[model samples]
Target chain A: MTVTSPEKAKIELRDVRKSFGAVNIIHGLDLSIEGGEFVVFVGPSGCGKSTLLRMIAGLEDVTSGDIFIAGRDVTELDPAKRGIAMVFQSYALYPHMSVRENLAFGLEMAKTPAEEIERQVQGAAQILKIGPLLERRPGQLSGGQRQRVAIGRAIVRKPLAFLFDEPLSNLDAELRVSMRIEIARLHRELGNTMIYVTHDQTEAMTLADRIVVLRDGRIEQVGTPREVYEDPSNLFVAGFIGSPRMNIVDAIYAGDGRIKIADTVMALGQNFAGVAAGDGIKLGIRPEHLNVAQSSSTALRAKVDFAEYLGSTRYLYCYLPSGETITVEQRDGRDLSSGEEIFLRCDPERLRLFSTGGDRLRSANTAGMPTA
Target chain B: MARTRNSSARRLFANIRYHGFGIVVGLLFLAPLVWSVLVSFKPSVEARQPPLPPWPVDGFSVQSYDNLAQYGSGIWTYTGNSLMVSAATVVASVIVSLFAGYGFSRFRFPFKNALFVLIISTVMIPFQSILTPLFLILTKLGLQNTLTGIVLVYVTLQLPFSIFMMRNAFDAVPKEIEDAARVDGASVLRVLYRIMLPLVLPGVVTVAIFAFLASWNEFLAALILLTDQNKYTLPVLMAAVRSGQFGTIDWGAVQSGVTLMMAPCLALFLLLQRYYIRGLTAGAVK
Candidate 1:
């Protein structure tokens, strides 16, 4: 198989918008995917991730704006001519055809020579490790085997880019993990641009070179997995990326880089020049960042509502004095009983501040100064 | 041990009861065909007598079959005509309905739903009511008194139902399969011929059987449209044989003709029974 050079696989969407009669699906959106990048579009259902992928694949028409693939304007091209292959969520293999025929169908349609088609089919079969099952129809294969055949079909095309629409969504948990790894390895070996759309955050975090987080037909954040998880751009990104999700608690910003949570006031190490004293702000912290602290004037007091044990770590579901609940990741394996009073504290640098309107508030200075 | 013995006896009785009911029902349906076949084998003198102990009481003879063979333009000519008309109808109906069903199930165009409803609604119109107009139209087109004309009429009559069955079959296939084909570089026609036609084979078989049976057994249209004695189909020829010479019905010849006509229909339904059942219930459940 010929590798697609990174330069020849770039895909760009220019002010694309999709509407269905009276309702709009994808608002005007522009995005450039570098060649050979494994980009995952992660969002909840109805977020237009699949719609965007379909438009790029030419399966769905672009309501407005243009799609350029490999420096060619392919907005009016047929799906086959777009030089992209897609693996559907359902692994749509032709039931009547053998696995070999399903993989060779595209080349046959293109009128390639029989020997050449055979060689390519064999190569794809070898790559997907499905040679033994070539003569069998799709009905005889397991779900994972069928998915491999679907991908193998795409591979024989040697497309410039591959688009996968929740391809692993139908597999069992163990198979999903293995297939995810196989897909990641496929991208690396082929060096083709890939756009994967999935609702599973684990898939997005583990497989994406860059993740595009979407919500309500709009992009919420586009960043590396680590970047999105560690430094979310807004409250939505912060809440959507993590498993236990970031703990968000309402706070009142005090003068001179200090914020008050319930009855406890702590010094915020970073300076917030735009914040005013007594202004309502939101404090965001990951579950792992919150630690059980000794009772002190600075530590926030809370009652442990529930402790969930997961063999290695426990999650402390705590209720603050203000009646807001937050989760803490306790890694020391110490168990805390429900209804016990506790105090929680975190390093100021591990904190994130969000405006009440859901935008992230960047710190104004790096100087560490206690503002008690 | 006593309980086990009792349960075994109950099982045996249940089996006997179940199979006994099945055998009675099966024999009830088979009785008419079996009786006609047995009577057709009887001597003309005995077959013409009142129906009793349906089989030939005396030695069996092929005299009735011999008489049937000598009817009209010969039984072979009529059988050939019926086969030709039925074959033509099946081919035309299958080809037209296959494409029509694919279009109805997959494509989008202006008034698509309305067009489909219009095609399907034709099934509600009775064939007898339109026979006069159809005859006039065939006469104008120079197709009257022709086997092609009979086939054309049968195909038209078969279309509404054949297309319905075919559409249901095509509709039951997942749209994703077609999408996968199109993305795999198959053209519209290729997708229908290679991918789709194979998947909907049972539906096509069902449609073909219906077309063949409809054209084969039809008497009114064939009688009204065909003028030549050489072109008379089995059903028309059988009608003529029933109203025998000088108003004297030949019971032996009628029995032989009935037995002959019943063969092909029964054989076809029995041969394609699996596909027939599946095609009827294609989209009814899912």
Candidate 2:
């Protein structure tokens, strides 16, 4: 019962906009998603990431523009006709039904033959590794197990794409991490296009082939996780990605590709276009890039406010002379006390510079990332 | 010694006060139903005796049960009518209310809040105020004494509160589930049928039971709407029988008939007690 890949299309959206009466959401978003690629829309709460996913799935009506899925103009089509399956935050399992029945629900609705439906359900159950739990209701299973059943339910449909709206948000933290990997693996095996929506940055970073970062109903940046992280398009993406988040400190352009921060003139060896001498800018450095400076390197002197020590690393929360704080990820596990004087050095090449208006400035040659 | 004495006094007083109050209240409410069952087994003279029928029944006989079957005209017919009407009311009201409730809960149209307020306001209006006009309207439509008329009347009357219960039920259900359903190729109605309906079933059942009981036990409207003895429902017949049209009350027959009328509702509650109490605990979980 294999669906013969159905000639999947590069889902393209042109000036897609949505609104609720006078209040507009999703302000003129334009994006093109290639076939067989997994894209995740990640944002802070109330950013309309889920709203965008719903629009793609045809659950929401697009106020403006066309959505083409598989080369079919489906902007005004019914959800059933749109060829997408969704896994929800709450799983949306039919409580009265067993896992097997839940998995077979979409097929049943489609009026598939009973044997084929059974085969599809069995295949999904095996894929999700929830075959043993197939006879149980969602209420009878644990959160992780219910999530598997939810995924299995989607797989049975064998749609052109999968839409997930924070499917792991209901689970505990540990389970979320594991399920995140499982979903990534599922995408690899299925080789179908998938679009997931979540507010969890880890979910976006770990799972997305291309991450769509949204803020306040508008897409801030869209790129691969490495592309978005290593070369963020905006200051929002810089701050949003990474665990011990990227530190943003106010700095001024200092006569070259260099920036002056808190009495420290850092030498950036590359030339940045459109950056002027006195332009107010912010230096963005990932915690892992900043560390304890030794032997008189160009350093930003700071006092450690506190430290959060993980087994493998410790995050030194340090503040510059002007009072802006930056986290230094010390990998060698040095135990630093509060108010300890420290010199933090970022290897200038890895420093992310954003103009005051929050746009990522294109430098001539930032060593780790391609300048755009 | 003072601490120990005070603790003992507190325990003794607490046990007497709380437990005593609960027992008294329970007995006060339960006494009549227990008395009703007991009195039904008593002989005609014993039922209304100055001392009242004896507890545990001095002697129970089937004479009343037999007399009820033989002497009560249209009693079984009326009971059947009540069952038909109420069952129809439960099914019809639940279906219509579920749709309207979903609409109110999910969709936003122009004047949405005003529409919801209007629906809720119907609940606050006294049924007695609209009874005459409603009856006249039904009469003009040739639905006056028919079971369909009764069902129609019952459904419309029950709809307001039914919608209220179901709207809250739909609200308690995560809207994300329906969104998921829609994304899973379900149409709006399919989403309701597949995902939303089953989750809110306990609430729907609770509303249905209420609808069932209201229509089954309804007396005033049934009395006004129906004239034919065969068309009379249980409550209407029960009220008429209580008048004791024959010189002295045939307490045996009346008791047995009352007992019979109570059986279905009791059985229904027992069968659906799980869902009935589930309404209380619906949104307790996050």
Give the C-alpha lDDT of model 2: 0.84
Runs with alpha carbons beyond 4 Å of true place in candidate 1: A1-8, A262-266, A273-279, A321-323, A365-372, B284-286
The deviation in Å at residue A313 for candidate 2 is: 1.6
Q: Distance (Å) between predicted and true CA of B187, model 2?
A: 3.9
lDDT of 2 at A155: 86
- Model 2 ranges off by over 4 Å: A1-8, A294-298, A364-372, B1-28, B53-59, B65-72, B145-147
Q: lDDT by residue for model 1 over B53-164, one digit each (tens)?
A: 8989997889999999999779999999999999999999999999999999998788998988998899889889999999999999999999999999999999999888
lDDT (10s digit) by residue, model 1, range A255-285 = 7889999989999866685577888999899
